[model samples]
Target: MTVIQWYPGHMAKAIRQVKENLKLVDIVLELVDARLPESSRNPQLEEILQNKLTIRVLTKADLADPKLNREWVDFYEAEGQPAIAINSNQGSLKAIENKIKSVMADKLLKRQEKGIINQRIKVMCIGIPNVGKSTLLNHLVKKNIAQTGNKPGVTKSQQWLKAGKTLQLLDTPGILWPKFEDPIVGKKLALTGAIKDTLYAKDDVALYALEYFVDNHPEKLKERYHLTDDEINDTTVNLLLNLTKKMGFKDDYDRASERLIFDIRKGKLGRYTLDFVPSSENDEA
Candidate 1:
């Protein structure tokens, strides 16, 4: 397995800025990719947000297994964490607003008792790179205020945006932790575009994706590439080479690897969930 590590200067600065601005916000909206709920979360951000009111926003639900989305939400909610899964492009965001208000109800009531009325909830939006943080922000505020891209590290700074009349969102650049302790976590991030393409070997992640599909969604993989049972059963490396030849790329395995990765990201094969909720907290290791 290839070791994946990418933490640039801007991310370090973003962490400092997040800590500095933590006092200004009433709540935190931690965004994560729906397919990789646990792996996509930044442990560094978790440390910075210590005891702060935070909601887990699982973005890109459309590209992830729908059943897993609900299960992940249940897993978080069962642990007493506020969480919701949304496609951001189409899912209703009313649930997010309602959850925020409900969580802050006590704080709001105290302010109301002191004669403060209609105070907007201040929230900080954060997530790993390319996990749809900016896209979610744009939908929440109903504008293209934050730059959206298919690549990582698009948003470089933080800014505030109004969501309707009640929520004020602080949009920050996607922040990844300095290191990934688990290699699977790194591969999952690389497969899902959370990590930049240049940061990891495409063949490594493509093989990882191929193995995942072979185990979990062989039919989709076979159908997508028109592979026979014997072909599908081939070893991962041989299958990759076969795919390269079938795609008319000849010996350019990198091109084939890139195609497989792009297809997975674009949902050409099918929706998938790389992370699963452990049956119990003790089972997490």
Candidate 2:
């Protein structure tokens, strides 16, 4: 399998721009995919955002395991990272507003005591590509102001927009780290649509996702593809081949792979979470 990594030239420039603009924001809204919460997080951004109050916004809650979504949010909050899970398509924007207000209350209070009033809270929104940052921004501002798409690298520049009377948002392009040290992390991001489809092999990602479903969600997989118990029990590669034939693609495994990946991303196999909460250092990868 090819090593999965994607860091466009613009991303390096994005890092520099984020560092330069850090001082402008009162807090950082770090959006992550709820499906792969830990894997989708950019450690580089964590390093750059040192000492800033950050709200870990777990986006795409509607497509993730509902129980796991609660668990992940609790896990982050327990570790002292203020976190909330949101479905950017229709989740409560007021919840996001309240979280920002709660974190900035102390600082805003101090400024107001000195006679500063109606000061808009400045927020820097950062996340991996396609984690729904732009959709959240557009919803907050109640305008289709940010360019949004189902693919990565859509938002390539920094721009500021207002959200209600209390918030000013500085939206930044999504950043992927230079390398994925853990191969599974790369596959997880790819499976979740964080990496562009063209950057990696679809069959490889499909196989990775297939194994995950086989292990953790067999019933959903069986139901989605009408797999028999024996078919589900076959070797993973053979299962892919069988599925290709079953779908009437006549030996076109690559097309089957693409269809399987799309089904997973579109939640046709039901809500799933690729990254489990780490219980120890050895379990983290």
Candidate 3:
């Protein structure tokens, strides 16, 4: 399989540093976009933090389908993992705190048995860029303790925050894997805005997004633009252009495409998640 690898020198250094610092934390709170939970995960993380407990937080839940989010949560729980869907901007931090306590229950009990009182469980927050790690930190602490931006690579250094009496969070920069073994993985990352749009042409990204939406999420197109499946299949760009015109664009096809791309990125079409997990039958590929 051809892999797309783009790990900047700084990120490699960061990963090495994180690996070296993993011993300082008691748990890892791995943040992933709820919309693209499977695709958003960094596979290398499992190997790096092999023996540590991990609590997966699916951030940006408001922008993902509720039903799919529930399914994902169930999937994780069934695998003996703790997972929660949450929106960083909304009032979901309390639930996150409760889940953190739940995941660290065993460790907390061990500390209690050892006569350790008022011990704080240190958690390292790790995820890919734009997964809302910093936003989550701010929400949990009720203050802007971490530097946050709308784009990727905003948080560059690691800072520790006290989430509560029982938990402390080590916030780190969002990190991407050194390589994407699957092309679809790279495509989904781009589609979900994990990779900056400035790195590639909007039209090309939109084209791939258009095809994926048409194939896996035809109902979203129908609901968002009143486009029928046949209309969507006929011509993706033209269908988008017509929808843009109806939405009060200047009736220019190129402009319409641009607007459609913007809407897709901003979750205007609907809460949609892209799946890129390779099937078991095709695992060799």
TM-score against native, each model: 0.96, 0.96, 0.86
> Candidate 3 residues 1-285, lDDT tens each?
123357877678779888988999988888999888988999989899897888888889888878888888888888898888888687366787788778888878888899999877788999999898898898788799888877788888888898756678898888998777777777768767788766545555566677878887888778877876677877766766666667776565555656666787788888777754344555866
Candidate 1, lDDT over the whole model = 0.90
* Tens-place lDDT digits, model 1, residues 185-208: 999999889888888888899899
Model 2 lDDT per residue over 17-95, tens place: 9999999999999999999999999989778999999999989999999999998999999999999999988757688
Checking candidate 3 for backbone clashes, the offending pairs are none
- Model 1, total clashes: 0
Per-prediction tally of clashes: 0, 0, 0
Cα-based lDDT at residue 222, candidate 2: 92
Better of 2 and 3 by lDDT: 2
Every model: Cα RMSD to truth? 1.8, 1.8, 3.5
- Residue pairs with backbone atoms closer than 3 Å in model 1 (clashes): none
